[model samples]
Target chain A: MVQAYILIQTEVGKASTVADIIGKIPGVMQAEDVTGPYDVIVRAQADTVDALGRLVVAKVQQVEGITRTLTCPVVHL
Target chain B: MVQAYILIQTEVGKASTVADIIGKIPGVMQAEDVTGPYDVIVRAQADTVDALGRLVVAKVQQVEGITRTLTCPVVHL
Candidate 1:
């Protein structure tokens, strides 16, 4: 499985809503709202890196109020 | 002196509130709500790395409904 952390930025007052919507997505293990530059942090897994990328670019990014996302795939040394 | 970004995730319907409160905390330079894997992203600084830790552990982490935090200190090469 490929695990990754995706950092999300939402609109001025839409963090929680965005997180809630994202948590219900497939492959998303956990989604939460927090304080910082990012409004939501998600830990997710997929069968391959390409799948993870597609998930981020297609599903996660389509949510309303989401402005930007940075995907950080877990790397094992 | 050190600079870092704190990624946070909170419970459902709590991202905006958490970010609002964290923005008022001392040393927090910026706090904004976002969508994706993390709910909030905060950029801040202190006189030292240890101080930054205290800020995160004592102040940022103290917010109610916050589930977890990941601190990423910016390293200069």
Candidate 2:
């Protein structure tokens, strides 16, 4: 399984709504509004790296209010 | 309780070790090595926001090999 943390920046005053919408996405395990450089932090999982990339580009990015996303894929290392 | 995500950058080749040490901290719920701009991603909690900040500075950032840390505190709205 592939897991990643998606750090997101949203339009002004949109963090809560964006987090709420993202939390319901199929692969999202947790999505919460946060205060810092990024407005929302999301934990998600997929079957493979490619699928995880697609999930970020297709599903997560398409949500309204989102301005940017930084994906960090977990590694066993 | 106050929760936050600490995005960490570690010295080259130190990601795994940093994550290992951080995962053992008392307030840390999860710490994992990841591939991206940041080297490790950690989820932690404390009794208050101030306590969370102290946890990040006094504990998480003190770990050897860690270069930088950005704390994103979870917010209800």
Candidate 3:
């Protein structure tokens, strides 16, 4: 499986809600509300890199209040 | 006392704008807008953990359009 760390930004005061919602999505193992440069941190997985990209674009990014996201794929090296 | 990677998210199409604004903040070493889970990533530091927190909360967070941030302090292990 391909694994990635998805960093998310939400509208101010909307982080906790966004994290909670993302945590329920399939393939998303965990989504936490955090304070710093990014509001939500998510760990997710898919069958391949392309699948991961699809999930990010098709599912995660579709969530409202999620202004932006960065997908850092885990590299074995 | 600390150095960190700040991952940021902004309203769609706001990534470049956010990065530009944050790059000018004091103590911000670098701010780059990238495609992924984080729209903008920043490297910064302060004398102590508290100062780092203060910089994040008082300064970085004050930037308009910055919805959330996550401070990943580099750890020596």
Candidate 4:
């Protein structure tokens, strides 16, 4: 399995809602509101890197109020 | 506890060593090598936000080969 951490930036006052919505997505393992440069932090997994990219672009990014996302894939090395 | 996910960047070919060193820090819950924009990802906690700042600046950043760090603190909201 390929796993990743997605750092998200959301519109002001939308962090909680964004996180709540993202937590329900199939590939998402966990999503929570966070402070600092990002508003939401998510852990997700897919079978391949391409699948992960599609999950981020198609599902996660489509959510309303999201401004940006940075996906970091977990690596054994 | 004030918990955070710290995204780390390291010199070329240094992700594993950086993660290994960070994982041994007292406040660090976990640290692992990761691909994409960031080379390492870390989970850490402290009693207060200030202490968290100190932990990152004083300990995590002190590790050899680390180039940059972006600290995202977990929030209840």
Per-prediction TM-score: 0.54, 0.97, 0.54, 0.92
Candidate 4 lDDT tens digits, A19-66: 999999999999988888889999999999999999999999999999
Q: Give a tens-digit lDDT track for model 3, residues B1-77.
A: 68899888777888888888889998999999888887899999998877886787678777778766778888889
Clashing pairs in 4: none
lDDT of 4 by residue, B1-77 (tens): 89999989999999999999999999999898887788998999999999999999999999999999999889997
lDDT (C-alpha) at residue A62 in model 3: 86
Give the per-residue lDDT digits (tens) of candidate 2, residues A1-77: 99999999999998988999999999999999889899999999999999999999999999999999999999998
Q: lDDT tens digits, residues B3-51, model 1?
A: 7778788898888888889999999987766656778777788989899
- DockQ of candidate 2, scored on C-alphas against the true complex (2 decimals): 0.95
**C-alpha lDDT (0 to 100) for residue A30 of candidate 3:** 99
Ranking by DockQ: 2, 4, 3, 1
* i-RMS for every candidate: 13.2, 0.6, 3.9, 1.0
The residue-by-residue lDDT of candidate 1 on A1-77, one tens digit each, is 88777878899888888888999999998777756566777778899989999999899999999999888765432
After superposition, candidate 3 runs with Cα above 4 Å error: B1-77
Worst 10 residues of 4 chain A by lDDT: A32-41
How far out, in Å, is residue A49 in model 2?
A: 1.3
DockQ of each: 0.05, 0.95, 0.27, 0.81
Q: What is the lDDT of candidate 3?
A: 0.85
lDDT of each: 0.82, 0.94, 0.85, 0.93
